[model samples]
Target: MSSNQQSDNVLSLRGISKTFGAVAALTDIDLDVAAGQVVAIVGDNGAGKSTLVKILSGVHPPDSGKIVFDSKTVEIPTPAAAHRLGIATVFQDLALCENLNVIQNLFLGQELRPLRLNDVAMETRSWDLLRQLSAKIPSVRVPVASLSGGQRQTVAIARSLLGDPKVIILDEPTAALGVAQTAEVLNLVERLRERGLGVIMISHNMADVKAVADTVAVLRLGRNNGVFDVNDVSPEDIIAAITGATDNAVSQRQARRKEGLSS
Candidate 1:
């Protein structure tokens, strides 16, 4: 995947720090998500992955840092503020209404209520959004509960695309999915990049990272270790970074395997 030099980046974070009750959730975190790129963040259980994304989604604020979007530094005080800045996050829960159909769920919070919703107009617009984003969801009439895991992810993603956001954050998009479903979701992520949207994905699956991510950013404990091009780093190297041994060279288990091979 090629990095877009001409395409302006949509996000910049410098010296980001966050804490909770004297425990540091993040420290000195610096990140960049350029428009038209897919950045996958991976880490171990306590790697502060959630904290970093929460800051991006406006669920939490950085104790000290700067958030710059589209050449302007801005404070994201709330989710609504982030929305106004064209930053949309599709969280793990998806927050869909179980009884509502796809069309209804997509327009849930931003419903066109005053003039009776004009179902035709909404569906038409929804169709356009999904088509523009190249989302793989086949139908828009089924309840969100009735959709498959991949389709549900597609809907959640589609909902976020309604406002043509510059930055889209997705949390663990394929966490509980089967192989085929995971493939479907990753394909949708690629589609997002094709549409010129800056995508930041938090995922545990390295295979998905290798498959869909252009750049992989590793967060170790509470600080960002580095960002490397997916093609330039091996999964084993990423594992080491996430496991907090990025520069030690030979991890113990790898040494043991090497010694065994020689024996």
Candidate 2:
């Protein structure tokens, strides 16, 4: 939506809304993600970030909205459908099997050959995927549990790429990671963008958003609050949008100070 043509957007949502019993989780939300761009969705708790992610990931269908993918209106009825449509979501928990090695986890259910169990082929493809992201794993045969937080994230993201998805949704990708690990994940995000994949990064960390996202989309009380180019917008403005404090006491005080200085 930030000057990107509709044709360039790999995923777009219009009039997206969702309700749970009597609670309206989302209302009239609109978003756009162009290919090879990183758009960060930031909001306070209960601001409907999770609901919107679920809707796009096909966990829950929007009550009324149009989802345009590849310039075609489409309905993502299930997670599988979302994947089939080139939409991949990596949730915060990651869902990686700690007991399984990186290679085992990558091809858990989608191995190369069910009958033959092509370990060599799967390992080769896994290495190829990891190399594409410049992952820092010592060995693919090691248990994922032995990997660092950032390494695990790299494995999960690499697995998501196996399907050749056009759009990848990352939910709080740097959460619980150390500063070094966070930087590593952010670098991987840049690699994803370089690969020409649309990236929707949901995070509460303003620093992370500003560090990697091209645009920031704010959600307030389940509605579109504001969207801004990361380079053109300040972190304070983004936080103000998330907290719904754009015209609040602090801003009024700042405005008065500016007026007095100008006078």
Candidate 3:
């Protein structure tokens, strides 16, 4: 894919490739994410979604690529470097301590006044972050384990915001969530866009993508298949790009049904 550098893009990846000994995980991937927009990355398993996320998250460096953040080419050698560059990634597992409350989890290592331990200040900041996201949690003092799936996701996302990141990458934000819970998470994603944060959501659910994403970036066999406007592209089109063919079962069934209708 061509990396057409747009002035509005907050994050851009060009010629991104990674290899693990004999296997090539990603090859010449290009993606762009603008401020206040949600870019959903969709692909089947082993399509290099996980590898791409790791590169952005600083878990693994790309073998070859250019990562431009905030209009400057930068290197993210560690998780700290990524955060320092205003890129925050919330993985599927969330990495929240079950025993800790919302306030504790939000400021886990980066607490206010580490020597003195400012409880009131941390609690106030936690409430402010949750309120900004319009998160629905009865109390910040409640243990993370007591929260529902959606609530936990809200907490994870809110915590990411504490760094005031220019871009946020969410891995499977609505996976395993019930219908209502999924809707809740989707609403939060919208809120992030409204806050003028560039969001890169990695999801398998096309419905959720259509609901909140402004653009969909599809990766097929570790290469760029297509980038589409969510408003113009159908879910089937995206799926075809993902699976690398239109002759698959879904498209074939739709084609046969269309033929029958025209007959």
Indicate the residue-level lDDT of 151 in model 2.
96
Question: Which candidate would rank higher by TM-score, 1 or 3?
Answer: 3
Q: How many backbone clashes does candidate 3 have?
A: 0
Q: What lDDT tens digits, residue by residue, belong to model 2 across residues 1-263?
A: 34449789999999999999999999999999999999999999999999999999999999998999998999999999999999999999999999999999999889888999999999999999999899999899999999999999999899889899999999999998999999999999999999999999999998999999999999999999999999998887998999998786656777899999999
Residue 153 of model 3, lDDT score: 95
lDDT of 3 by residue, 139-222 (tens): 999899999999999999999999999999999999978998899999999999999999999999999999999999999989
TM-score of each: 0.90, 0.93, 0.97
Per-candidate Cα lDDT values, in order, are 0.87, 0.94, 0.94
Q: Indicate which candidate wins on TM-score.
A: 3
Residue pairs with backbone overlap in model 1: none
Model 3 lDDT vs. the true structure? 0.94
RMSD of 1: 3.2
lDDT agreement of model 1 with the native: 0.87
Give the TM-score ranking, best first.
3, 2, 1
Pairs of residues clashing in candidate 3: none
Worst 10 residues of 3 by lDDT: 1-10
Model 3 alpha-carbon drift over 4 Å, by segment: 1-5
Please tell me which model should have the higher lDDT, number 1 or number 2: 2
